[model samples]
Target: MFRTFVSGLILLLPLIITLAVVAWLGQFIIDYVGPSSIVGHALTTIGFSFSASQIVAYVIGLIVFLAVVYLLGLAVESRLRSHLSQFLDSTMRRIPVIGNLYDLIQRFVALMDKNDVEGLKSMSPVWCFFGGLDGAATLALLPTPEPIMVGDKAYHAVLVPSAPLPVGGCLIYVPAEWVQQADVGVDKLVSIYVSMGVTSPLKIPPLPGPGPRKGNLTAT
Candidate 1:
């Protein structure tokens, strides 16, 4: 009987945990969108016009949340998005320490958003040699196609993300020859970083020559 009970309990664990999660989510929704809360009351009021049931009011609140998000996505394509984004950035930047964190998080999120074709596509994975071709080779990301000017010399913007959380990193401006664009996709590179070097390319070609060390990179 003890053995049977243990087996039954083990079998039910998954279902129990799943139910617990669903219950927690439902409570969270009620706490945030229930009639007692400010936003909840507003949503409930909007929902009441369509249905008398309070349950329906909560459902309508979620619908409103999704609708607002959809509208915001559409707004991204409009000219007003620039002004709105600038205003938002300026407002957040006024908060001192947290403001800088917010800005970093925003850029990191933009870099990770694969659906954002223009923003995310511009950043490509590359390998950077710290002191030049002879220095240590580090897998990094190039945020732009063109090189940025550092005095008279041109430098490629290299973002070397830390292991595990690619959220925080140092941006290095390296000379053209120091940066060699990686053949791997952003997703693959991110996986390798997130896995702490556990996941890696099966084979990577050896670093090429100390050919043209001067001037911008010419098309090969």
Candidate 2:
């Protein structure tokens, strides 16, 4: 019986959550705009009181909600977006630890925007092989296009972003040969990490065996 109940609950959870959300939307509208509030009283003047003004009010509320969201979307595409983003950046950067966090998030958000990854010109997705050419590979981002010369050996700085967050991680310096070009975009890479690898990337391309391919050692 317990097993049956658990299985049943699992099957019904999605529907239950959907209905709960819809009911909450209805109640919120009734409380603020449509039926119980002044807007509800105004709606009554238009004979909107079906089912004691609840169902009709909820419909109106849903329409209003969609309109507000559409307007916000339009605003995001306008000049106001740049000003608002700059204001947010300056304001958020004043809050110490949170400011640092906001900067990280802001950079990632820019990466996700198809039209605005200019801020990440120095970064690119890569597969970092550990130990040697045939070693374990990791998904990472090159912090800079050029390799740093560390005592005659060239080392690349790669940032290994944390999974499910991708906002913070550790940076490591490795040989140029350890890094390979990953045929993935910033947004797709972020999505894969945020989903904890449940959303896998495309098939890995053929890599050189054992050591660096003579002409392919540069980080793209």
Candidate 3:
């Protein structure tokens, strides 16, 4: 009975959680722009009375945001995007609670857009030690005109994210000689990490050995 209940929960939990999140987000937006809010007053003054059906307005706002993003992506040089991104980043940084979150998100976005495996090829790994134990190591590149004490070290960096969620992790200085290039790609690495040992490309079972010879099998 316990097993059956657990199995049912496993099947239903994702659907339940998804609906709950959707409901919460919808209510949050309604509260943010409802009749008593500043946006509500402005819209009302403009002869547009807000209603519960204005959820469609929220969807339209999302569509407009996506459309603007698409248009920005189509720009030839990305100069416009850079300027807009900088402006947004600056504004986000001014918001107290959201500033730190935005900065972390920005860093990840910049890394994904700008960094490549080849760029990581010449980098090395920096080992972090704690309580006489090796905690973690990250591949990274360093900047040039290297510090005199660290004069010979290469100039480049790569952040090595922790398991489960690769979004947050330590930043370390990696030398050019330390990082070992792998045949597996980043997408595969992400899958391996997210699945938390349940999935692995390397776990393919070996083919069974050839059957015993006919003469040897005859005795059996």
Candidate lDDT values, in order? 0.76, 0.73, 0.48
lDDT of 3 by residue, 1-220 (tens): 9999999999999899779867976776667676456665444444323234555554455455568768877762565755876688799999998998886666454434434443233222222222212333332222121222247544223456666566556655444333333334455555555555456565533322332221211100
RMSD of each: 8.6, 10.2, 14.5
Per-residue lDDT of 1-220 in model 1, one digit per residue for the tens?
9999999999999899779867976887678656777777887777787788987975787698789989987897787788878899899989989898886667667767776665566577788887877788888877665776778777787789997667667888888778876777788888888877979977897655562344434321
- For model 2, residues 1-220, the per-residue Cα lDDT tens digits are 9999999999999899779867976776668775557765655544443434666655665566678779977988997888877887899999989998787667656666677756555468888889876789888987566778789787787889887678767889978878877777777788888877978845766754544432454433
The residue-level lDDT of candidate 3 at 9 comes to 99
Q: Highest TM-score, which number?
A: 2
Q: Candidate 3's C-alpha lDDT?
A: 0.48
Q: Pairing residues by index, what is the TM-score of model 1?
A: 0.51
Q: Runs in model 2 with CA error above 4 Å?
A: 1-77, 80-106, 208-220
RMSD of 3: 14.5
Model 3 spans with C-alpha error above 4 angstroms: 1-52, 76-105, 114-130, 133-163, 169-192, 197-220
Q: Show how many residue pairs clash in every candidate, following the order shown.
A: 0, 1, 9
Better of 1 and 3 by lDDT: 1
Instruction: Give the TM-score ranking, best first.
Output: 2, 1, 3
Clashing pairs in 2: 34-40
TM-score of decoy 3: 0.38
Clashes of 2: 1
